[model samples]
Target: DIDVLASSEDAEKVMDHFSTLPTVVDVTGKGHTKTSVRLKGGIAVDLRVVSPEQYPYALHHFTGSKEHNTKMRHIAKSMGLKMNEYGLFSDEGNENIPCSSEEDLFKALGMTYIPPELREDMGEIEAALENKLPKLVESKDMLGIFHFHSHYSDGSNSIAELAEEVKRQGYRYMGMADHSRSAYYARGLKEEDILRQIEEIDELNSKYKDFHIFKGIESDILTDGSLDYSNDFLKNLDFVIASVHSQFRMDKESMTKRISTAMDNPHTTMLGHITGRLLLSRDGYEVDLDKILGKAAQKGTVLEINANPHRLDLDWRWVKKAKEMGIRIMINPDAHSLSEIAYTSFGIAMARKGWCEKKDVLNCLDIDAIKKFLHN
Candidate 1:
């Protein structure tokens, strides 16, 4: 959903402007507080006009998880303040409290400002009230990322190209987790291909003093719950991301057990897209998430918050739960192309929304720290 906010005076202009767009099929509520523009493809873009003083209030109000906003209003009420999308007011005199930004609004309430990502009412309010909100991991905190592909698999770019792009983006390291031989549909790399890719990565690392690429692969977990490659081959790689690429219909207990067994592998470094979900397309496989988290916690296995918009697996809710269980989280773009590498931004948002701190994310570490983390 495309949501936008405009000033009250420019409401008509804003509404009229978008209505004339070539993609717009219909427009309604032309001169009202809100206008809905129906695009040719059936997506509705809603625009709401508010006063400058109301922007901050309206922004959060409109971005509601409903539960979070309601809780905020309740807190305001307890303080004898009237809170609404228009503005916060004193109940005694109905005087509007001035707020130029969201932070100001929170400060006025005597609470720490909460990021939009954490505005889901998932303990954020309570944490904010006590000034105990997590210092959520930000985009700048990511020093590197994992689970991106290369030409060795189905990716559009070569390993060197991807590594150079990652370095250009200011990352210290990146992990090349191409599809394993089992994922033949994705041009998965075979044993020989992996060997060559490892050699290439080694060569690249030697040439570039500023960057390093971890030799990694997204190994498939067979239905029997074993990883795709032998321990010897898997050990040769710097990291291995175990994932369920097929058999989404496996029952909860079986699927959970399957993933658990893979994590049990000594060479497994991380679990990719724990749910095997393709957002807006297919439901994730049935798995006991608590059990999976428990296994990961027991083994110190890192979890992937697949940053692909279509599959934000290791979902925000689970990301937070995983952190609480002392599990490390890695925001992998799961990108198959160069442009998609930026998808890590979305993963960072999800991670923050899940209350992740820099310390909780593996990529936030520097070269030495990451090397140490991976080696362990």
Candidate 2:
């Protein structure tokens, strides 16, 4: 469990209470002013101190539901507070207090009480007008994107073209997860083809300065829970994104075994599109998502929010479960063409619906961090 603190007194009170719980493991105070608290049972809490004057803005920033925060922002715009993740902004451009308190911030925002979970835009906007609005996520605080596809396998453009597009959109980086060898329907690359693609990516990196390419493969997790390539080949990749392709029909146990096999692979950095469910076009293949998501979190693997309009697999509901378990996520447009590269925006929007933030997203990493994560 996580807790947010507002002051030294608050921290002391928490520490005193935590001392009584036999299961508590550790307590760490982080953030500016050491306002955070960690519980012993692997539960962490952060405490913030917001001045009474800045309470509204602080509460708005911390109490987040992307949709709710969005609605609250509309209220702030009317009231003249330019709210964000860090703090509320005044039109005069003064030094920000970065208020750390939640309740005080809410009071400042002039809103009635609303919990974080209830912040979705359902009716929060109307509520805020009467001094109530659910807190939401802000677009500016978002770092970047994680998974995407290009012409390397079934993608439409070369690695260089994809990088250029992501850069144009102001993203820090994009993961080049082209299809694996078994996806013959999408022109999946064989071992030699994979090596050749790696070389081309190297050449592109030499030519491009602003963006970097990650040597990743969207490898197929075969029906029997085996990857399409040898271990030697999988290790050569910067990251391996394992996914299920053909044989959508199977029992729950079989599907679980298939995914378990892939997770067992040390090279598998992510489990692609968990549910295999397509939003409107195709009903997703059935699987034990709770089990799969739990395993993924334990193994340090991400679940892809396949951003393809047709295949928004790993529905937003599961995303919530992943968030609770601290499971990492990667949202990709599964771009097959240059035009489709912009689909990251669509994916990001969907992630917001699941209450995902940059910290929860793997694609938010820069090239170096990504390299370390994959290699280590």
Candidate 3:
């Protein structure tokens, strides 16, 4: 459900206006404190009348993960205060304490302001109490974007077109990882094709002083746990993203072994979307993430948080665990179109939800540092 904010005076007007929109199919609970509406595509939305005086408290309560809100309420109770969306109140006389902002609401509870992304109740409250919450990674921290595809491999744009567009969008570098030869459906690249692309990249690099395009491929991990290309061939690329595009039904143990073996390859720079889940369409293959996470930690394998909305794999929870293990996260939009490159914002959201700091993300690396990292 989507939460919409409106003042008491404007709440009814907002709902009436919203109900009249062409996209809205039905409305319910009209003229009440809250109204629910069904959009054309079956999406549900709620418009809540959070009065101006209590707006901060309403936002804090409504946006927080249920567990986080519960923990906050428990803390308030311990302090002899009652807390709700309206405001924090004294238990004795129901006297409301005023809060001008979410930060003030947090301060009243003797805690530091918690960012919305980190409000998962997974140690955030405790960290806030100790004034030790991490400064989460933001979209501005990224200097480049990875996992782009061009027309050479099932993508909509050509290399030159994609490069010019990505450069104009303000990133210093654009890393392209088209499919390797094994993905016939995508017309994945052959060795000669990769060689040709490298030469093209070199020519493109000569045109601009501030930008560089990294030659890379999304190598398929075969059933036997080997990458699509030979190590000699793979080493030619600036980076490699090893992913599983087929064979999603292996038992947990075999799947785990398959990914673990790939992670051990020094040429395998990053492991893409640890689970092959397609959001609402399909379940991820059975794989032991514990083993995969441990393997990545041991070998310093970069775990990719695929930023495609359908696959936010290497899910935020796992991203957090990997971060704690000193694993580096590369949030790739897995973009197949120019518009999809902007999906980096979604990846940053997932990374922030995972409690990632600037240092925890690979995209935050400077050009020199990233080049060194790619070589390693």
Candidate 4:
């Protein structure tokens, strides 16, 4: 629920502003303190106005998963306090506690501040109490990105152009993991094409002393649990990211087997979009992710958090488990265009949601560190 706070004098003005929005198809309800609207895309939005003094409490109470709020209320009850949207109160209902910010509210409850992304009742409260909540990964920590495409495949830019853009964005390094030969629909690179691209990358590396480009490919994982390229071919590249772009209809057992086989490949540096899920569109193919995570850990394969907004795979729910299994993660934009490269921020948010710290993300490392990790 989206909660808005404003002074009593501006409540109606705020509601009026929303009512006049071009995208609002209909104003379903309006009241002294609440207004609801349906957008052009059939998405419902709610706006609630509260006093400035009660703003922080209302924000905390509403910007929560029902489960988290319930847990918080229970904690308050045990502490001889009563919590509500307005504010925390004494059990006798005679005193109102001051909560000027979310931090104050958390402090009042005797816990460290919890980010909204981690407020899904997923052990965050307990972690906060113990003061063990992860220092979550942020966009500033991304020193480089991986799994991007170029005109060598279906991308809009050339290797030189994309590399320059990456350098412009303040990243120290970039990996060009264009689609491999088997992805004919995407104009995947052939053996000869791969050799030429490698040479071109070498030329660019010589030109730009500050930025480095690793020769990589997003090789397709075949139906029988084999990679699209031979080991001899894959060994020539700096790294490999194996992904499933077809044969997504396999049963759970088969899909799990397919991914496990890819992870076991000696040249496979990472696994891309583990579940093939597209948010709000397609459900990721069904597979036993536990098995995949175990195999990834066993093989020391880095799992990817596809940074594309539409495909933030390796869903955050499995992030903590992956870390526990000793698996590291890389956040990749999977960029096919220059603008899409900025999608790394979205991936970082998802990483934080998974309780990931800087140490858990592979791309947060320097180029030298990444080279060592990939080589190992």
Candidate 5:
């Protein structure tokens, strides 16, 4: 239960009950007035108490986006009022004044109207004037990364280096999907090499106890509708991100057929870089997206939102359509270097453009959820 308290005694009672509850307890007390409680079964509760004159305005300011609160606070200060979670105060020291509502508070501040959805630092102040702010997904909300490459393929970093980098970037986990055997030009892994790599990844896990590394492969979809590796090999990996590497010139129907066969496989957890399209360099493949997305949704496979600047394929234009059709996306940076990890932001930007939420991205799942999706 979420309890927005009005007194310190009431908050103490709730905290006392919650502290003794089974499972877990996390408390964040910012000051005398603001205390946040996270319960054992994943419930978050916050409590605050303020003077009557400051209550409504304080409530709105606290339960707002950081961007929204910052802009509003600035506007309030310009009008000689101080705003914070505990209360709003007149800069002129009129403690007996009565400001009872959020609308009234903003009106007193003399700022134009703003929407909550657009309060994500996308120039909402200017947009609020023109009424054209875009709601964007910031980089911090993503839980994990789906597709990444390393020294195993044409990538420039080692698995340990890549894992450390993602951890430093504050992600829960990252999946390593170096190229498969069919990508011979990139020195993709053979079965023996893959086994060795998995062992190494396991060894690394033993070394770093706080994070996880998924043993995934970016398996190529052959021209004739078959995956690069045998089914037994594919099943052994944690996840398989299948993509079109060569034979990029097939006709529309044949191309569709090739992808269809792979999507039919339960072991193929995701379809990589749909359309195989490069943003400005090369023309993307000509497969029918509607048919592909439909099959993928039905087969329970994810579609990769390739985050490399050159190949932000899947266009994001079609992402809304895919989401509406019930197809989940895996936001992948296809990272090959430390700097490339930031590409996850690019993917998030595109996902927001497509109207995707945190739940819509498959990689946002916990490690257990990801494993469940792969094995199912």
Candidate 6:
């Protein structure tokens, strides 16, 4: 449902305009203030017209999680006011209060503005009341990208092509974490292939004056809680992202232990897709995330928030816990194609949903700072 507000004289004209839209196949219902239509795509859309004064109230009421609306109404009632889709009014039949925007509404209610994304009734209201809400991370804060694939693995683009695109996108550095040897299905690179890739990266690094490409690999975690490559092989790379590509059915204890073992490796720079979940499709493997988080904190290993829409692993819900444990997060696109690289925005959303600030994200760091952290 979409709600719009117009002057009394323009109400009918607004309704008429919607009725004539080419995509609207049929007007199912029409009334003075409400109209429903079915589009050619067979989706029903409803539009509710209201007085200009009620726009903010209606927007607030409709764009809500049920609990958020309920809490808002309760706050209104406690102040001897009535709040509904129509407007906020005094209980004694006084005139409506003017609310020009969501910020105005929140101000009138004596609370700080809460972003729509944070309106999940998950302590956001209380945080707003206490003036303690975090300043969320934004896309502009990201200075580099750390986890991307190349044609050497399953990716569609070659190293140089991906680097050019990354530079075009305004990032200062790119980490090519192509699939490691054990991921045979992805054509994971052999030892010789990695050596050649490094040589290629060195050549590219010389070609670009401002952009740097970090030689990294997404090494697979073996079944017995070890990395795919030997320590000597792993140490040759700039950084390593350890992940689980198989053994999805391991028991929770074993799975947690497996990840913990990987974290214990000094060469394991970050843990990727901790849960292995595919949104709206396959469920993530079971593991004690709290235990894994604690181990990661102890080992000084970073955690990855896989940005692929299909697998937003390290789900937003755990982001707070990860932050509280002092674990730095890397919002990785896990991109296989040039277009998929823009999926980093989705990871940024998940990070914000978890109340992440600029300091909480690793890619927010500049190239020199990132190098220092990686080497440390």
Q: What lDDT tens digits, residue by residue, belong to model 3 across residues 48-109?
A: 88678988999888889999999999999999999999999999999999999999999999
lDDT by residue for model 2 (1-376), tens: 4535343324444446544456545545434333444455455655565444554554555666677778777776787777775566775674454545555456566766655555666554466548644233344544455455666566667777777777777776666777777788888888898788789878987876766777888888998888888888787788888888888988888998899889999889888877787765677776888888878878888788788777776776777678779998877778877778667666666666666767777777766776677788
Stretches of candidate 6 exceeding 4 Å from the true structure: 1-51
Best by TM-score: 3
The local distance difference test score of each candidate is 0.89, 0.70, 0.90, 0.90, 0.77, 0.89
Which candidate order results from sorting by TM-score in descending order?
3, 1, 4, 6, 5, 2
Q: Residues 239-296, candidate 6: write the lDDT tens digits.
A: 9999999999999999988988988888999999989899989899989998998888
Badly placed stretches (over 4 Å) of model 2 are 1-146
- How many pairs of residues collide in each model? 0, 31, 0, 0, 0, 0
* Candidate 5, 119-197: lDDT as tens digits: 4444556655564533445566676896888898889999989998899988878898999988999999989988999
Error of 6 at 339 (Å): 0.4
**What's every prediction's RMSD, in angstroms?**
1.4, 18.4, 1.1, 1.6, 15.0, 2.8
Deviating ranges (above 4 Å) for candidate 4:
1-9
- C-alpha RMSD (angstroms) for model 2: 18.4
Model 3: weakest 10-residue lDDT segment is 6-15
Q: How accurate is candidate 6 locally (lDDT)?
A: 0.89
lDDT of 4: 0.90
lDDT of 1 at 93: 100
Give model 4's TM-score versus the native structure.
Answer: 0.96
Off by over 4 Å in 5: 1-137
Q: How high is each candidate's TM-score? A: 0.96, 0.65, 0.98, 0.96, 0.65, 0.90
- C-alpha displacement of 335 in model 3, angstroms? 0.8
